[model samples]
Target: MKKTTLATLSLAMLGATGAAHAQNSVTLYGIVDTGLTFIHNDGGNGNSYSMSSGNMSGNRFGLKGTEDLGGGLKTIFVLENGFNSTNGKLGQGSRMFGRQAYIGLTGDTWGTVTAGRQYDPLVDLVQPVQGDNWLGGIFSTPGDIDNADNSARVNNSIKYTSPVWAGFQFEGMYSLGGVAGATGSGQSYAGAASYSFGQMNLAAGYYHLSNGNTLAARLAGTTTWDSLFNTSVNAAYQSASSINNARIGGNYTFGPVTAGGYYSYAEYTADGRSLFTRAQKYNTGSVYAMWQVSAPLQAEAGYTYMHSTGNSSAKYNQFALAADYLLSKRTDVYAQVAYALASGTEDPAGGQAQAVIGSATGDSGSNKQALVTVGIRHKF
Candidate 1:
């Protein structure tokens, strides 16, 4: 009798544990996108070839969890990591969980609110309307000057999103300065909204960030701007006191083909300690079209134009083409080509600017640049 009672009690305890486990769940997901690429101009030298990662969607793995609370609300969390698949290097400044790391609560009616290092509203809302949305960085802005390629992220942030109502959705984000004496220094804010009607979609967004006086000027343990201008095109603006960008984009679908376009304006303002006296500004515009050739194949083409003023006067014209085949639901093979031509003049013989396509670590020897990449991508 004693043995039977013990067995029954153990079974009841196991049943209660199972019930608690069922109320909460966690999932693992990731994508691996890698490819071999060829560039006509490598750091202004000759042609070169190498293996690349994150050719389409960035290579990443993440865990997402949710605990159901009563009344249509749940606590959710996500921890994501990004890496280079070629040699296995961590991305986003070599930080662990660099792609995304956040925890939040969700409501069926109130939408989601998350706090952590995260992408701004523009990257989340406005980027999906362009060819790069489907073709990847091959169609990205020349030099990614306006972050059309999502080159930067905000740290120490709080974000709020609203549910779609009447085909419209919106979101906002703010990052703290984390400085003791300065409340506004090293702070950033962004907002975006999107609308969809029928087969057409439109989006607009703006982002603003102010840098601390100096990385060390603020405090011993405080957040500072990471400075996103690592490219050859806009490196000079890294010392600016503030940066702002405004963008608008729209897309329309017709049967198996889709057409889209966008415009962006960005300004980098300086103070007494900056390299230049005035604010530097850039204007970028692009248009693209995609054709679904078949159930498993697609082709896309895009054109981009960029102009700069203030500290320098330069212009860039770029074009890209891509074709992709779906090998399976979670795997695909793709080929793409991109080229850029730069012209104009800047004092001190800034020389005719050289073309630097997408995130390629090379610059054209002359006014023209070209690159070709063949890649495979898998997701799980």
Candidate 2:
């Protein structure tokens, strides 16, 4: 009798543990995107072809989980890592969980709050209604001056997302510099809101960041600023001490077609240690149309215009077209082409502006540039 009772107790304990485990859920997800790319006039070397990674979307693997805590509240966490599929190397400066890492709690009646490395509010809200949602960075601003490509991610951030109410939602974020004695130095903040009514959607946001007072703090290789001006389009303003960006966008869907446009203004503030003494301002406008040709096929066409003043007077015009075909629910193939033309003197070299299709290709070394890519993407 004693032996039988002990076995029964063990079985009951195992059953209780299993029931508790069932209340928690975890998921592993990843995407692999690779492509063959061709660029005309790449860094003055005419006609270059190479295998590229992340033409459509960055390659990444992530784990997300939620634990039910009763009372309609849950604890959530996510760890995402980015990599280069072509070279089999880590991306986002080789951090283990470079893309995102956050933990927080959510409730039915209240909003969600998370803390850790994260994308700013503008990228979380406004980018969804922009052309880059379908065609990737090739459809973004010339150099992604306003972070349309999500080139910059904030570290040590605390974010709040409001639950949707009456088809409207909002998000706000602030990143801590972690500097002792200086609370505002190297800080970043953003706020954004979006509304959806029927087939129409609208979004707007603002972002600001301080690069610290020292020259070394604003340089590219550091953790404080991590400049996104890798391309020639805005490299001349890399020494800026602060950056401010404001953007607005909206889109409408009618039957199988969707159309949208966006405008952004970005300003780079200069200081005594900067390369340029005057503040640089950039204005960008873009419009796009996407067509769902069939259940499995889609096409998009977009145009962008960017003008810069203050440091130099320049203009950039870019045209892009792309098509994607879904082979399965989790697999797709795509082709994209873009051409860019630049005018006026924007180069610190005192020469005419060089066209760069997007952040993907190198400087054209001239006034015109073009890019073409055919890629495959798979999600698991």
TM-score of each: 0.91, 0.93
| lDDT tens digits, residue span 175-245, model 2 | 88877887887888889999999999999999888877677767743433346777788888877888999
Every candidate's CA RMSD: 6.6, 6.4
Top TM-score prediction, candidate number: 2
Q: List model 1 lDDT by residue over 1-380, tens digit each.
A: 00111111122334555534225666778888888988887776778889988887899888777777657888888788989999899988898988788899989999999999788899899998976888887677777767877877778999999999999999999999887787888888899999999999999999888866673432221333345665667766666777889999999999999999899999988788666677888899999999999999999999888888987888988899999999988889999898888887432236567787765444566677888889998878
Give the winner by lDDT: 2
Candidate 2 global TM-score: 0.93
Residue 295, candidate 1: Cα error in Å is 0.9
Error of 1 at 141 (Å): 1.6
